[model samples]
Every structure is written in C-alpha cells, then in structure tokens.
Target: LGYPCRDLLRAWIHELDPDSRQRVVGRAVSAPRPPQLKKLAVLELCTREGSAQVVAQKLGVSRPTLYNWKNQLLG
Candidate 1:
C-alpha cells in the first residue's frame, strides 16, 4: 500500500470507537511508517491504471491527497 491509502486507513481507524481504535492503534504503532497501504495504492494506480478520484473516494480522502501521492511516486 501507498502513503495515501495508509493515511486514509489511519484516519478511518481513528474514527472508530475507543476500544476498536485502541486495537488498531496498537497494531499500527508497531507497523512501519510506509506501510503496505502505500505500496498497494501505487500498484493499483500504476499497474491497474486506476483513477485518482476512485482511489480518493474509496479511501475517503480528497483528490489533492491522491495527487500528492502520484507526485511523490513520480518524483
């Protein structure tokens, strides 16, 4: 997964109930910063030719965030 998706997932997890959030936070705390979410999104967008809008919608983030990811990947 890519940074974009990981960020979105983190945001989603944060929105959950306290107990659920704690569980997720525990798992995430031990995880690396650039998690699979970033790689997955990059692969999905590059290899599968997915759209930024679709990815953003699914990830529940703005299109600008997706664009930032794309820019980061391209750079």
Candidate 2:
C-alpha cells in the first residue's frame, strides 16, 4: 500500500476495541504458515506488507521502535 493509504488503514485499525483487534489477529493467525503470529500478525496486516511507516502509525510508535522490534525478531 502507499504511505497515505497505509496510514489511514492503520488509524482505522488502531481505533478498534480489544475484541475487534482480537478478531483481526485471529484471522491472521489462522492463515496457514503466515509470516506473522499474535502481535506480529496485527502489525503486519496494519502495515500491509511490512511497511515500517504504516506499522509505526498503526502501533502508535516511532519508526525506530518498529525497526527495533524487527531487529529483535529477525536477529
């Protein structure tokens, strides 16, 4: 997704309640061999293909924070 589109989707997702968030996460988890799991799945979808800016926006976090998480996960 483009930066603006991703940002909008991120905001929309962030505004959802816990149950809604859980539903989205559950869908991601159920996808066979998905690259994401749990919190990571939420992040991946909200980002729409691992776009750092989108992920940060959805997460209400800075780009550096997203990078740190990625590093921790991949390292």
Candidate 3:
C-alpha cells in the first residue's frame, strides 16, 4: 500500500507480458561494464574470415586495434 501505483503498474506490465520488463527496462537498467569486457566480447566474435572488419566496426576500433586487443588479452 505504500507504493501501490508503481507496484501495480509493474504488476500490470508483468501480467500482460512477462517479457515486457526485460524488453523495456532490462538493457536500460544494466550496469555499465568495463571496456575490457567489450573488447573480449568483440574478440570472441572474430574469426579467420572477414569477421575482423565487422567486429572492429562494432567496437569502434580499427582492425589493427582489434588484433592488438586479441594479443593483449590472449597472449
């Protein structure tokens, strides 16, 4: 009864669509991670094919930078 309005709104959303909260607020509420984690994620997607360019683009870094991160993290 203290915060029925807010609680009811969340409950309604949950009842209508269980995934609505995730779709609407999950990413928004996520805590910011370090750059190393992002670099590692991008590196994991890298393959022997043309993935370097694609992943590098996604990380906002150059191809050489991606390779550098790979060496830094893996080697």
Candidate 4:
C-alpha cells in the first residue's frame, strides 16, 4: 500500500454513516486547508459527489494535486 494504513483508514472513512460523513465534512471545511485539509475535501467529494473537478475548484488545488490526493486517500 502506498500508505501503510491506507486500507484500514479508507475502510473506516467509507463505513461512516451518512450523518457522520456530513458532520466530518462540516468540521473539515472550517479547518485549515491546501495541504493539511486536502484529504478532508477529497474524502467528502469522493463519498458524496464523486467529482474530481469540484475538488480542484473548491479546494483551490491544481489538477495534479487533486489527482494525487485522490490516489493517496482513495486508492
């Protein structure tokens, strides 16, 4: 695994109930972003909207950064 604990963490994130996911994203948006908060937006986009385009636009990340984060967290 690119990330040693990737599978476990992904599983846990995926398993979150709808309300929980929303709450997590809610907190994430208010937190710092760019690098530190990239994953939160990626997770939210993947689980809810499944849109990479929006991730780039919303998170102010470049295409490569968005794709890299997606591969890292959602591989």
Q: Assess each prediction's global lDDT (C-alpha) against the native.
A: 0.63, 0.57, 0.67, 0.66
List the lowest-lDDT window of 10 residues for candidate 4.
Answer: 22-31
By lDDT: ranked, best first? 3, 4, 1, 2
| Regions of candidate 4 where Cα sits further than 4 Å from its true position | 1-36
Off by over 4 Å in 1: 1-34, 48-50
lDDT of 4 by residue, 1-75 (tens): 366487777677777743454333443343335655766866766676656777677767666776777787778
Tell me how candidate 4 scores on lDDT.
0.66
Among the numbered candidates, top lDDT falls to: 3
Task: Name the runs in model 2 displaced over 4 angstroms.
Answer: 1-47
Please give the distance, in angstroms, between residue 12's alpha carbon in candidate 3 and its true position after superposition: 74
Task: Write down the worst ten-residue block by lDDT for model 3.
Answer: 22-31
RMSD of each: 15.8, 17.0, 10.9, 18.0
Task: Summarize candidate 2's per-residue lDDT along 3-43 as a digit string, tens digits.
Answer: 56877776777777434643334422322323444358345
